[model samples]
Target: MRRFLIDAIVYVRDLALGFSRGWSRFFFLPADPTPLGLIRALVGVLGFWSLFVIGLDLHDYLGSQGWSDAAGAYDAMPPFGWSLWFYVPDSLLRVAWLASLAVFASMAVGLFSRTTSILAWIVIVSTVRRIPIALFGFDQILSTMALYVAVSGASGRAVSLDRLLKRWREARRNAAVVRPKGARKVSPDGPGRPEPSVGANIGLRLLQLHLAFIYGMAGLAKLRGPSWWTGMALWGTMNAGEFAWLDFTWLAAWPMVLNLLTHGSLALEIVYPILIWFRLTRPLMIAGAVALHLGIAVMSPGLAEFGVAMIVANVAFVSGTWLRSLVAGRDDEQPALRVLYDGACPRCRASMALATAADPDRVVEPIDLTAIDVKTIHPSLTAEACLRSMHVVSRSGKVESGYDAVTRIGSRLPLFRPLALLGRLPGVVQAGRVAYNRIASSRPRDAVCTDETCGIHPPVSVTGAASRTRDSSAI
Candidate 1:
């Protein structure tokens, strides 16, 4: 009995440790910021749209003469309801509304993203609170998106003017420094990738979980209604005077089709909160969500933005790794280019790792010339020449070597685009060639591994990622 108790304690201890690790990984793992940036852009655009419509009839909507005056709006406030419109005098209503529009526009394009994101949330929530009479599903979802986007602080990391300016600043800093002899040139995790952040993960996970909760609650609410079960709830929506766009009344002729759609959608919503958490089922659930939201938009054109806003909220489920590659014009199965390097050379392996580590963007495929036949990768790449400098091969069978190869890579990476542009200046390319040649020629190789088959690189595993051995002849 004592032995059994000891074993039980050890099992419990192991289970607890495993659960803690999983919890940390789910909430704190460093993630790419691209998806957060996308969500910000979508929310900003919707916020701008919301403000623009209000701005056109500022006095009629938000001013003293509006549907819901400041007095009533303030009186109707929920416990913590706050809105700047209440403080702004009627004389400055238009000015305040226009300023709110500008804030959303700036947030959309990611200008002063850190400051603008916070301002955007305030603007959205304030406006929504001020117009309680006109509020709907759109206001609710839009404000929710703004809240999380503001919290993330990672929305400007990609596809933003801020990113462009940052790259320029980095380029300027690099220009002031000169490389010493034998110094290698490469970005630690590929130039195109932004740094991973725990903050980004926190924001994205919150948004994802919140959206799941919403769908679960919505499904439960629908279950309380009789129309949803009879599959006639859709028919009611089809004939609704305020929401229906066209004559979906024809769906009445096919009762079975209506049943399929209504029941399927309801079932999907009910299962989404659970299934969306699983890796294998995530894609199906997300796709279903896209269909459901798009269907709502099509059926009720009046509430199109609300449908779109909810669909955009679902964007949080997207894998950061996949989003990064998609932005770089590649996917896991297809890399943009293959780079041949001498694995036996310490400088070469380290430089290659820097240029394409962790397979960021899935853009660069590093082929060790020592491990595989050079001809298999590219007819132009000979082991003798690859030993001297790295070579890049395009899918169309074009090949570039040395300085040309490095810059060719830069052309595909957005972070390196600014440098690529500067390299186009008449003397810049020539000067860069000289510098690259100097670095390449001085790169140190392994002391014992002198030839193509030095076998210095053992096929060791990294981060539990299986080291896939390539069939040299297969390529």
Candidate 2:
């Protein structure tokens, strides 16, 4: 028992280290101590907890009663029962249940993430307490996970409004300061400078440890069971018609196949932790786990949902480095093109800058037409033509003007790959380019607005000419 516990601790420690390494690389954080790394850890911990709460609610909803009966029970639960703090009416309970679902949904989107996480925990706990008889071990696990999420800051990245607000604030600060002539300008850093809290790191480490414990306990439980040791559990479960609601009934008809699947299932389950422990076999083990869950879903009527939840949770096991590399590879493929753009035209310059920023390896270069030598690169394209719209010189030295340039640039970036592909389709590219040209040409020559703030520009007609001129000057 002591040996098993020690092995479990070592395995979990390695997994945590893997997670830390992957996330640190993904966010481009410095090794050892980093604010971004700490944030990543916090977010991961919160995500795990959020998923746990969601899984518990789902399990409770599905486990106790049939679909129709559960619906009736949902309706029957008091809105504000005596068990609740305020002696809330029975209708309030129903509302709280619905609210819990909404909170979970919000958490998934990172909207009011912290508040939603808390609400989800409260609702889940209340619902579970209201009907203790119907709860399962999984439900308890989920509740505990939600509690963890409520205390951690997990939704601090791509999915959340919090990150967007932080970015906006940073941009505002950058714009507020005017650099003096000949003065060294300090670049405005990205997002909030939230200090890394040790509590957050400890919380995340605890959750990872708990997950390892769950796996170890599950393995131990299976070892102690007779059907698992004898290889009959899987066969019997698969062949049982009462549980088999899907097309897996065919397995019932084949004795040899059933026996093979049964033995395979037991062998795999017993050795799953071993495979997960070894870095080389981890992928195979994960794939097998997915297959196992999928099989469970197909063979057993209700067991499939639990299998699905487990599969979702397994995603946490994927190294952050692998995920980052996948995204980075796509970013690198975006068209390697240089655009000679007018930096003085705020809107034009902003778009070019954004494109270049999105693909930082100089995959897309936005050269200031006035500041750089555009004539040397493309003798055919006149400076007047380049000034009229965006001009892109492809990786092969082929020059495309206006909308064609945009499409060419888009094709090279990972995030815009779909748009690039669509640009190549019949008529679509021409139409898009034409539309872009019309919009660009109609804008005031002095207009300075980034894509995000460009809509503030008024019509170029004389009616609002004075105001538009003032706005352009201010920009």
Candidate 3:
């Protein structure tokens, strides 16, 4: 009995620890600020658009002579919230409206980003509170996005004046400082700013989780309505004169298609909250969300704004690295042959020099593993693995190592293409791999094994000696 109780206690403790670790990783894992920055920029644009929409009727809605006077606006406020428009005079209200526009502009450009974000949130809340009837999910989503962007450190990363200015300053700094002999050139912008708080991660996690909750609740609400289950909900939704853009009464002609869409939408919404949490199912669920939202935007007329707002919000849940690469236009261009080599290896350095000299146009990009952080560029390739063997990352994002990497590089150059082609023929390929393995195994270990900097200060004589020694090894 004693032994069983002890084992049970240990099991419970282990389970608790596992749960706690998982919770921490889910909510507080460090993230690149890129996604958060994208959210900030998008929310800024939407906030400005919302303000512009309100500006057209600013006088009609908030002016003293208009529908809601100051006193009437004050009375309309909910018991829990406040509105600046209520207490201010008509002229002050106009000034506030203009000031809100300025705040939105600043937030959009990421000038004083966090501060502007706070001001933007206040402007949104105050204006919406004054006109509670105007409030919708768009307002709520904007406010929520603003709240998180204000808390996060995403303001200075990219597509912002702040980032540009930082880059300019770093460029000037790099120019002023004279680097030591054989010093590895650091990125002009230097190391990334360490996140003071896990706010970016927490904010993104909250966006993802809250969106899931919203989808789940929406699905449950649809279950309560008879039309949804009958697959006729879309019929009513489309036929409503106020919400329908076109005469969707014609949709009655295709009952089967309408029913499939209605039922399929509900099924996706219900399953999304559960499936989005896992790695494998996440892409599928996100794609489904994009389709669902885009369909609503395209097929349903009046709800396009709502659908688009949801789609933009969904951007927060996407992986930052993937988004960054996409934004960098890696997908649009032809792939380059990225040569990943150990800088400390004399033969490797000599080979890189030879390749570059052979092709002055610079098609092959040499990546010194000693200088670059592989994690940022290619998360899958670790420094230890790169140190062990040469790696060739093809433009198509495929990784080739050992003799295959050599052949890939050689095939890309005009001078060596024939030799590379010959090396690939049947039994010749096997012999090349064997020779490559022996050469790799016999190469001396560089300072990269101990300290990454050791490769940067190789003896001058070593370069010449390594070039001569390389005649014996396969290039």
Model 2, 219-252: lDDT tens digits are 6777777876555577767767777775555555
Query: Residue 301 in candidate 1 has what lDDT?
Result: 86
lDDT agreement of model 3 with the native: 0.69
Residues 187-301, candidate 1, lDDT per residue (tens digit)?
2322656777887888898899899999999999999989899987777877797888788878879998888888998999999999999999999999999999898899898
**lDDT at 104, model 1:** 86
Candidate 1 C-alpha RMSD relative to the actual structure? 11.9
Structural similarity to truth (TM-score) of each candidate: 0.70, 0.62, 0.66
Candidate 1 is scored at a TM of 0.70
TM-score of 2: 0.62
Model number with the top lDDT: 1
Determine the backbone clash count of candidate 3: 1
lDDT of each: 0.75, 0.54, 0.69
**Compared with the true structure, what per-residue lDDT tens digits does model 3 show for residues 1-475?**
9999999999999999999999998878777666677777777888888888888998777666666666777776678878766666777876888888888888887777778888888887887777766667778777777777776655545445565455444433332222333222212343322232377787787888888988999999999999998998888877777776767788799999889989989998999899988899988888888998887776665566677778877877787656644423233443367788765554676566555433313356677676677766576888767776788887778898889999888776555779999999999999999998777655653332333523222333333322232222222
Better of 2 and 3 by lDDT: 3
Local error of candidate 1 at residue 338 (angstroms)? 10
